[model samples]
Target chain A: MRMKRLACCLAIAAFTLPATASAQGLLENPADLIWVSVSAALVFFMQAGFALLEGGFVRTKNTVNVIMKNYADLCVGVLAFWALGFGLMFGDNPSGWIGVTHFVPGDLTGGEAGFMVFQMMFAATAATIVSGAVAERMRFAAYAIGAVAVTGVIYPVYGSWVWGSAFEGSGWLSERGFIDFAGSTVVHSIGGWCALAAAIVLGPRLGRFGPKGEVRNIPGHSLPSVALGVFILWLGWFGFNGGSTLAADASIGKVLLNTNLAAAAGVVGTMILLTALRRPVLITSSVNGALAGLVAITAGCGSMEPVFAVLTGFIAAPIAVFGGDLLLKLRVDDVVGAIPVHGFCGAWGTLAAGLFLDEGLFQPGVITTQLLGIGAAFLWAFPLAWLCFAGINVVLKVRAESIHEQRGLDFTEHSEVGYPEFQTDLPHAGRND
Target chain B: MAAHDNARYSRERAVISEVLGSKLDAAGVQSALDLWDRKFAGQKSVPLIEFVNEIEAVQALEARERHELRLALYKGMIQAAAGPTTTAARATTRATSPTRPRVEFKGTPAEIVFLKIVQYYGEQLRVLGPAVMQQFLSELRAALEERRMPGMLGDAMATVAMRGAVPDGVQWGNTARMHMLAQGLYVAACKAAGPVQADRILLGAVNQAKQLEAAKVFAPSQFL
Candidate 1:
């Protein structure tokens, strides 16, 4: 399946050539297309990891619901991105803040399509993360609406400002030169913020708090699933970070190395802190912290040096650990620490881009540019998200199940149970009541 | 209930006793374990937080240097809220009622009609939560008696409110905008129900709250 995907993507890359050689100057090289295609595939696979991660975190009753949502997110993202979602996000009609673009290129080329595929994976990724964070009790239909809004509208529109909305130009697109080389602010933060809004509107899962409002530790049902999910996510990060390099150059190897190095250090850092604090090592924190490092290194993966990557990632772990608690303090119930791992750390990553980017990374004012990019993404995302979610929350019955029912999202939302019945169906016997 | 699902269970700080274990003051490990314990307890109250204030004590002892003192108390309470209750110094006048009333917006008395009725309805059910639990409760008792047949209220309310939190497509479809307003009453009703013994009370309360809130928002003044 992987080989076929790669071959098909390569075939697409070969087809963007124009009759005139000079016009080709404006287009991307085929290798970059290959790089993007592979990365997109990796990020796409993270959806599976997300499914298991969420399913395990929730109770046994809600496993199927979480898995189903992850599946639906991919469907929504593909359709939305292919349809008007892509056009609205990347179109050239920039009015200083927002704009739209059509999928059809006046004269179509396959290389550009590869970038579309790559970006599509990213859009899908952002969309999927929300499902896991807001899992278990949310109405499948209402949650689907939120997912559609994310891939179709939120992810794409914000994405267009930095990358090309429909077809990225050399200079301007989206809101005109919004500087996200890779989408730390654009992708991770968007997912994080949306998770924040949804969890808020939905309220805490039942029994998460006691009568006095003290939090109760809710343990996941599966250890292997959580561990495997983390490892899977860690493996996927190579594509998420390295593929952002856009080509198979030695520079990309640096991005990959730095990404791996950061994640490794993040694991060590979290473990050391956890142990020193004399706390048993928390798998959730460890996973989230490592993911945090990966997310932190994403924006500046190629731009910064190894030392800076270490600093950026090293800073990310503690921030996420502390940030996770901040959500509890604020009474915002994030199921998997989504707000801390993505939202808070995403913001930190963007800001770190400002502080860490050097000659190895970019020009002197790169810090300022990174700031502008991060700030604008927030200014654009936060209010719109709050409004969109709050408005829907007010209008619709956002909570599909009560606190008791929420303990098992699958039972509340879907018909099937997460854990399969160990015993098969018994011989049929009918009794009339 | 039979099994503990704590993934990190039994992995507490290792006590290296006999080997250099006799008097190893591993403050680093001790503090880390304490933080973990506090996190698990869901009570931010960590012991020996005073060391954070005393620089000399912290500086003098490396192990307790990075000690984090979490003040888990809420507002004025210095101690935890859930321990066994001590006998009061005096008989208390105020009562924390478990069966607190579900709030509602009673049809404005004769002088208030139509627009005023709608305003009151909006106030009671427009998504912020039924104005106040006390008022909502009194009005609910009256409204249920008047509009609903006593025997059939629960199932009916459950079906309707279970329809969902928000209306689809059209914004605030069928006065659903007011649904958000009733959230508070629903909460108070549940909290008032005390520790849940049956799913019926919660389901019934949610349904009733939704029904009352919905009626205020969905119905015309004449219906009220």
Candidate 2:
């Protein structure tokens, strides 16, 4: 009886809250609001996915630091996004440069609250992507500063250029008919390019490259953790992509199906390449391939054919592998290959949307417009990130000292360790060195 | 220093003395070792020897009978004063590892030549004394790392950029003439895009640098 009363109260509040005319029916439907809330919760759960993924990839000594960074991504992300990012991204601005309203979102209606909650997860997701790139050696203070900058300015300002229309007017990029049904470039590329800048500025971890410019392999600590993390991220992607629909319609099933197909194609494509190159069929590369596909399809999943989705994912596999190799050659030590999986593949997917959409690339100006958006994203993301990191580096040492890095950030930065082998008087056993 | 450090240092000193005995007279040998001690201070000598061995000038001498002697002098000085350290040991391990060293060019030949010229100037400019030199070198090292400038080029560029050859007591390095010499070498190397051209350009630049140093005109200038 009490549960019914609570439901009744929520229903009344939903109806009483002011909603846009277009959203009136949506506000009237309690079921739709519940779906949005549930979807937002699932997307928020992806923070755990990122935490495990990043933690498993870094050295055991730095595991706690990496996980801490992941947690902070959401903690800082939510506050920053609420205070400034949402307004900059979604508020009305005639110039189309930035959103000028909704700061702190104090007067939000019921529908707006649901929307804000959902978008908040995305803002957190973008911030979490950077945590993986600068994992072991970044200073906590530097990461915090970077998180705030990304959530508050770098991400939302560009988000205003693309995703602003869902709330008010579509960004100028959307005005040009650039299609990014979900953010491959807006979220992934922004974070990826930011990672690139941070990695470049941080230099490589000690001994990552030799005096003669020889590259060394720094393997992650835990494959099992990696596997679990990838699976969770894969599961969460259903909400990430499907929930973008913002409705419980039949089309969501197609989006989910397409998401899975692309992921499978990504695996097959990566495995085939691995076989051809005579490389081992390791799960790390496999997971990366699937992620690349997921990132690629994100731009067009809502509008693409299932077969084309597979092709997009298949193309993403090679792009991700080569993109990583390129960063290594450039001496950018992206710890989790975020630059390739997110930045490069994100750009490719955004452009591919123009190629595979119903009108196709042959359509006059569509390809050009998409190219413009892609170029704009890189031009905006890479330099702003470089400047942000450079500024932080000036205020605080962005990279840890050699001693701190050698001892591990877990103890040096956080005064704690993830594993308790010494305290327990047990053998040190976990994650291959 | 610990016993192990002393033992290691002594062994390195002995190896350097043996190597340079042929190329250097006794007094010259002592002077070189003093320079090394004054320059490198706390660093290890092993990597210094290894670093010089990687240099083309030292490599060219290796073709002659007195190559070991020439290398030893360079190695000894670097060990005693300034050259290599354990930090470089990690890098050396890769080069000597059973697996092939993953050799990639961090700097082009021109860039490396530019670094070598800078090192020579750094040594000459040491009359400015340790405090000034150390602070200057620290700034130079930071710049080099930021620019990915070769370590050899660090002190020279720093000297040129920060303390151009001037008559002021506080500004006692990077004279106007030295500025021209350094710039000439850098420009020559850049223009010498190919390997054959690199050797010619470097040799010519070094010759010009030597002439400038011989003149030793103390002129105040902002050529840098």
Candidate 3:
């Protein structure tokens, strides 16, 4: 009787062990992985949108240089994220300041790649924002180094502080209930503030300011291209805001609708302001206004009602316009208004989430928590970006020479021009003759 | 001209035109002619700037009218330089006083409209003082170049400069020109070099006139 009972126990143990291990191997839901992967692809495509938008807004003489810098951001950013940024953002955190594990994805088929790729796109996006602010002047070598530093350290360190634990017990910000729904503080603001820092370090482009410190207009090369780029970004924003949900569920529809509504509200609000101010109802400003709305809404798209989303966007438009003016007033030469559209508006959106939290969903100290997050992000991003750019300048000279600037970065740096057929008179043509 | 030389000349001309839009007038024509003789006729580099202690316009002209004025001035200069006995040469030899009317009337509808508006605004023009006009012109020009409605300028000067509250019935497309004309007249009324940069005032007036021309106005009264 004893032998028979022992045999029965052994058989049951054998049956359960293999099944448990198999289940552990299939821990992630296939549908979720697929959704996240697709979202990553959508996010990746935004790099192209950024390239076109930035390239089009800059002078035609520097289009190739803009394209090259944007591409380098992704290239350098992705590799940096893969090697250290992902781990630093998601590793086990006893200190709640930085991640300490998962350097290169230990599990290939365990759905880690999906998460890594999505996050990598976001890291690349953050890195690229500085490209526009410093476009037409930054040296490629310095820009490459800066891209690596931003993606590798400056961006990820702050990211870990806010989103390190993924809603678990990973970081101090998360512990304090600091909410940044889709990284208004983490991604956009970091990029925006960094752009501000970079612009300050680089100074204004040639002919941007007068001897008396007067502001001058440097119009973009092509509105049609800018319009198209904006549309692409608008379309990709679904992935930007929607994919943040990290699921293929009903919530995506609401997030997407909120994103669209805010963008539209931004356009209307900006146009109204332009009409009131006696400025032309420029398509360029409108596009930027819409982006401001989108950036602002990104923080609270998931938490707030659609109405608040519209309000957030409506208010963001003016902030973008005025904030850009403020930067110029201070002599910071942000070429693409990224500081206003992303940095200022990003903070507004993050705080708005706290003020406009859904009825009865508000936590006791969430607003304070949001402010802390905003202050922290600003303090971290701006100073670090300033330091990074300053330090890089010491090594590689962050800004292109004045002669190179007059020649256009395309011809001076890349030995190419975007519109060579039409650009027959290179700056050096007279000297060459 | 060689093909490359032509391209350079056109590019420089375009830059000058874009930068000096709507500000081109009788005085501007004289200045351009002087500049052409001193610089372009000798194949010298365009210095990319024209200095004027103070320039003001009593009327807003259409961009087209200012463009035509510029084209005519350039053509005349080229003819005078290329042939010493042409009518253009004779015209070029005549002394041009800043206050003299250089733009002629061919009785085209656009020119008639431009002349009429200039005449109307001339009566209302007041010299606000050069400093005030200079600052105002700077604000207005920046606003125009940015294609934004002049919120800063409007807020700062609308009470003193505008003819009246912008009418509710005004078409959206015409709003910029209306504000521009009102501001131009204010600058003209307040003309006198105060604290404003002379060159900025002059360049500002020329650009304002060019903008007016684009909006379909003709010759505006030039203030210097």
Ordering by DockQ: 1, 2, 3
- What is candidate 3's lDDT per residue for A279-359, written digit by digit as tens? 999998999988999899998999889999999999999999999889888878887888999899999999888877885
TM-score of chain A of 1: 0.85
* iRMS values for every prediction: 12.6, 20.0, 14.2
Cα error of candidate 3 at position B11, Å: 46
Going through the candidates in the order shown, the clash numbers are 40, 14, 41
Worst 10 residues of 2 chain B by lDDT: B93-102
What is the TM-score of model 3 when looking only at chain B?
0.32
B156 Cα displacement, candidate 3 (Å): 43
What are the per-residue Cα lDDT tens digits for candidate 2 across A1-433? Answer: 9878865654453345332333234333566677778878888888888888899998777899999998887899999999989877877544566666666768766767888888889988988899899988999989988999999889998988988834445588878888887789998888888888888888877656534455766778887898788888888888888888877778788888888988888889999998998999888899989999999998889887898899999999999998988888888888888999999999998888888886553565877888898899889988999999999999898999654654568877887778857422111122212
Top model by DockQ, which number? Answer: 1
Per-prediction DockQ comes to 0.03, 0.02, 0.02
Give the TM-score ranking, best first: 2, 3, 1
**Comparing to the true complex, what docking class would candidate 1 get?**
incorrect
- Residue B172, candidate 3: Cα error in Å is 56
